[model samples]
Target: MTLWLSSGLIFTFAAIALILYKWWDMQCIGVTPVRTLVFIAILFTSGLDVGLIMFPLTEFGGYGNVSDNPEYGFANPLAIEFGFWAFLIWGFYFLTCFYFAIIEPRVQFFEIPVVKFINNVVIIGTCAFTAYLLLANLPWYLPELSSDDGVVPAFYAIVFLSIALAVYSSSKIKYVRILSVGSSLLFIALIVGMWFRAFVLGQGSPADFFGTASMLGEYFGNLNKF
Candidate 1:
């Protein structure tokens, strides 16, 4: 698994390097050209999901226990968490966007009927899986709303409503842009709110916050190990 992951990382970087070398000054215009901020907002929202927001707290303990999980010993738990969520993982998205924006029009490989059908099927499957993840994790986050078996109608209703809203929003590009930018702003606000709560309202000092954040430097310092 590690070898496979290493190879993927190497390939992603190589592809990114080649793309940059070939089109250093080229602008990527999408089907509908939007401002730089909207483009970034779309990418930011599309590249992440609720799982990322909820994953670290659950995995941090395992990552920190290097004695049991020696594979994670190369870096601190914070570093491991950051490495999982950021850095080279995002390169895959970059490559996909680049391909669709720059290469797909020329090749038209995805325009084939079978390929388009398969692509849409994969997209629908992905969305279903994402919704399932939310449904499965909701009980843990909101135990009060869950039954004894960790399943409840309320959870199902919430997930159904979420999917319904997402489908409705996706019917138009303007709705997608609005939701993407709004969600990005909301995520930023969430981060700031948490930081303020932790350092300002809570007992933790500003220096403590910085000290905790600085632990992420281990990931950068030991990038090759990751």
Candidate 2:
């Protein structure tokens, strides 16, 4: 797992470098500042998520784990790993897409880049895998995504497929587009709420609100609620 996770982060780091290089090259050619920023936003937000702040607090402050139980003495090394990689993945995504466009000039990304064949497979696979997990992990697969209710591999599979769907679906369906936009707004609200709760209402950190979301532990559908 460590190797897998580290390798992915390394790949993203390399891609980010390549992407920035491409951006600089584009600027030399004639891309406008506004266009560059727009591309930057798309790339930056690609890996953004609800846990951006929460997980760090949880892992570093020692609030995470299946039992909220840190290893008692040692800090979680993996938490740092996750934190570092989280920063890279979004840029990594943007970099790859931009790089692909510069080189291929016409091909869509896939494997997560929106290449047509890859897109078809990902959406279908998402629905199928989700159905299978909800079925196999019956009774308790929803709580912590790392639940004991279903096939363990299913949990891993969904982690990524869900991400792929979120990225790919916006271009494919009106409903999904609305949903993606709505969720993006919701996420922004949630982040702002985090600060509000922390400063105004004195609700610990915004991550404290995540505990209230435990009710959705059993919800296995769309993430509009989160």
Top lDDT: which candidate number?
1
**Model 2 residue pairs with clashes:** 109-113, 109-114, 109-115, 110-113, 110-114, 110-115, 137-150
Number of clashes found in candidate 1 = 0
Q: Provide the TM-score for each candidate, comma-separated.
A: 0.87, 0.44
Cand. 2 TM to true fold: 0.44
Model 1: per-residue lDDT, tens digit, 1-226?
Answer: 9899788888889999999898889976767888899988888877575535857656778998988999999988988999988776678778998998889999999999999999999998988988887898888789789888657899999999999999999898899899999998898998999889988889888888788889999999998786
lDDT of each prediction vs. the true structure?
0.85, 0.51
Query: Which candidate ranks first by TM-score, i.e. highest?
Result: 1
Worst 10 residues of 2 by lDDT: 217-226
lDDT of prediction 1: 0.85
Q: 1-226 in candidate 2: lDDT tens per residue?
A: 7678677767877767766665565632323223444444443444354345433433444423435653322323333435344544556556656565565444434444457677688868965765554444433435554454445665657656765666677564444535545666776898897678776888475465565454333222321211
- Pairs with steric clashes in candidate 1: none
TM-score of 1: 0.87
Could you list the CA RMSD of all candidates, in the order they appear? 2.4, 11.4
